[model samples]
Target: MPVLLTKIEGKGNGIKTVLPNMSDVARSLSRPPTYPTKFFGCELGAQTSFDEKNDRYIVNGAHDAPKLRELLDVFIDKFVLCKACDNPETDLTITKTEEILRDCKACGERTGVDMRHKLTTFIIKNPPKNPKKSKVKKATADGATTPNGDADEDAGGDSDDELTLRIKAEAAELTADAAIAKEDWSADTSPEAVKARMKAVEASMASVSLAPAGGDDDSDEDGDSPFAHLGHWIEENREESAVEIYKKAEEFGIAKKHNTMTIIAQTLFTENVLTEIPKYAPLFAKMVTSEKHQKSLLGGLERLVGVLHPDLTPAIPKILMAFYQTDILEEEVITQWGTHVSKKYVDREISKKVRKASEPFLKWLEEADDSEEED
Candidate 1:
């Protein structure tokens, strides 16, 4: 996140609404009536040129208009230059100049101007750029190639359709797996067969991996693969015997990712991990109006732990506490929670509430580390 503070010097032409505080430039350009000018007696009320073809107002003579240039020298002694790159050659024309707004011309650094000083930081989050759309031979109704010479229909739709189909099929199989796993106790099947069948189903599902294939092997591409360990675990624990899959996940680090972890934890609670309290605990302590997802996630977590650790009673609170402090959970999980909370609930609660709630768990983790060192 980079904070840019710029001083508003002079009034810019009001017609170009997007111009950042180039008002001083405009004031300098306007004549005092006694001064001589070619375009005489034309009282400029924000002079703007209309691009009829594009249907947009463009600033053509705002910056270096002859009258404006003279005023700039008289009134404005100095202009605000970008601190990151001290280039005085800044075209304050808001609408037309795409290059300046998109990125810095001098240093090639991305820049945005915020009028105020509060930490309105801009972080550059670049998405993975995929291949551009290739033009195919689009057959017109008359069986002739279109003017653009590109097939408009079924070009992009084909890939999207394929992805949708894959997701739907995967969801259906998962549903079936859940039903089978739940009823394995009453079903007429050997435990080994049940396990084997489940494994096969899981393998088939796993084959439809989400990662884009045939890309350059970029090691620096550090990303969390969304192949849910829970999906794999569900397949692993098809047997009626042993511990439930959820419990094992808790024991292991399955729901370590914070956002997913929070959901899992919430799911566990909803499944009555706390039989002591029939009504679910108030999740999103900072957020007054709770998110339904927080409840669902807690239920999932409870079920996971309950299934895995049926025999040994789980330290539900401790596990929840542990999860809050986990870097994986805090980094991955809380970011999502923050996003959901901010979007659905009050935006203010996201930063303050999440940070406050997570701190206890973080502090507890530090103490645990200290104890281990002492031991």
Candidate 2:
């Protein structure tokens, strides 16, 4: 939540504190920009105007960024965050009783807001719209209605007919003799047969275990690993744009592969990765589409920070936050990644260092999850 403050110059009444990025800040907080702007007005006993057309939020008089930020924090504590889970993912609903309730999506808790505040009246008057209800209504109108208005009855009858046919088919497959044969079935309990089955199981398990290990060893040494080749190409073409890099990766036929993001992460940035992440975020967004890709990208980052640039190892939380903000990483993936230290990505010692540096962010995530579970 970076504040972009602009102090307006002119006469006494014309002078004001302009928050150019208030809308972005409000979006990140999942609150209407007017809510926080009005809150500042109420707290400072000053006038506030929001020119939504131009996305300009102005607070009367000359207020410093620090003071406004502090006030915004107070507003968040009272309005934005859920009381039960302290999660920002809440919807402010004005009940029939004129009380403002925060419905938390994370914990499913409906907690009341203090009605005594000046902002409460404003919130009650201008309640947050529930897009879900409108979407449900649209779906019902589009799919649940018919010209004769008999869609429900027809759907129910079709389902019942399908069920009856399935039941009849299942019944036709089951003869009395077949049922008797199934019930009379038995396995061989002879010692020789049991030993043979055990030996077969052991042989299968041994083969399965050895297969992957041998294949991995061969692929790694044979220079057939897609990740190794992709990383090398990316390192050589470091000056290319993200789109160009992606096109080249597509030519290599590994753009959509799960491990491609790992290669990109490992090769794309240097020690200044914290600043360079935004530049290459699009490449990551394109490659890392699923949980597996996210995990692989994290693995690549583990090597990048933990193994490659140990000085940037302490910046793990910032790196994760950058990825999270850029929409490259998700909360579940990050939480799972932080819970365990694996040698698959980096050596055990380096993995521990990365996880240790990530403790603060991981602790915050754990606390939020714990609070959600408790509620």
Candidate 3:
């Protein structure tokens, strides 16, 4: 239902229905766009194309916006919206026997996926990863106070109801995706959003390691460094969150090293690190509190930013935005750090570029604060 706009590309038999709002809709459904796109293809008997890099989903033939939207509603009804409570907060869990179950958060009900549906086959093969910790965190936060002054066990609220409506309304937007600029600070902490972010980081890591070793990139082979060995641990432990990774580094004596922050900055966000930041903010509470650590943090960040393609410089803004949102990266700290340039962690030129890259986001944050004061 998310801003259900479609663009038709090409002519004759080669035409396709490109859902511009595909990613937005998937966010509403709490499922990946591939699931719904593949569902549509199976339902319509048409081939589907997925361009993950651009977040584009295309199905063969020209399908009317209303028709596809209707299909999306059906998909949501069966797979997304909880049956018992009619809520959107649910997790698809697969049992050892491979039975697919919908674990409803709102009503504590267990509903099985329709085994007869063709989508079941795909669902069975690609079981959606359960985001349990984030869910528990959200549930606790959403809990209302009881008359006894204890938090309610049943975490139902008007906020959830409002969220359900907002998702549908935003999806129906003909122009924008959602009011995220104002909301991401809070909403980015949700279970589904966190999972989506991890998946996105995994997708982006491919491009991060693409550039060669000449100007600003690391020259040593991935086989050379102790950090590379730590990175291997990250690859092997796909299910572990960043906090776990940081602890693992401690267990291996990597966290105490003077170079630990630098290594972590390189290896952290490569696997669900941003999604883990809010969950592990307490672990990093003192990270930038001191002048010495702040310098090290900025140095690590510079090294991490050095190898990425220049086109991705815009990411500096969003990275800073997330840090500011989570209160992990202090505004005063980042603003001061951005003004001074040093090559302590990375090449001299790379240090200058990363700071330059951070300037726009810092300026935006300053203007935002000024506007808030005026209001």
For TM-score, the strongest prediction is 2
Question: For model 2, where is the 10-residue window of minimal lDDT?
Answer: 176-185
Q: What are the per-residue Cα lDDT tens digits for candidate 2 across 1-375?
A: 656465664568788888888888886666788899999999999998889878988988988888888998899899978999897766687877888888664455689988899988777777774433332233234345321233322332333224324433333332222221111113343567445533432232222122222133213444355545555565554555665667677776767676666667766767778667755554564456556778878887887787566898877877886676444576667878888888776668988889888887666555545555565
Per-candidate RMSD vs. true structure?
24.4, 21.5, 22.7
lDDT of 2 at 25: 85
Candidate that would win on lDDT: 2
Better model by TM-score: candidate 2 vs candidate 3: 2
lDDT score for residue 91 of model 3: 64
Q: TM-score winner between 1 and 3, please give it.
A: 3
Model 3 TM-score, 2 decimals:
0.38
Candidates arranged by lDDT, highest first: 2, 3, 1
> lDDT tens string, model 1, 63-142?
44455445334321222233367543221212233222322222333444442311111111211111111111112223
CA lDDT of 280 in candidate 2?
Answer: 59
lDDT of each model, Cα atoms only? 0.31, 0.65, 0.58
lDDT of 3 at 104: 64
**How many clashing pairs in candidate 2?**
0
Off by over 4 Å in 3: 130-375
Give the C-alpha lDDT of model 1.
Answer: 0.31
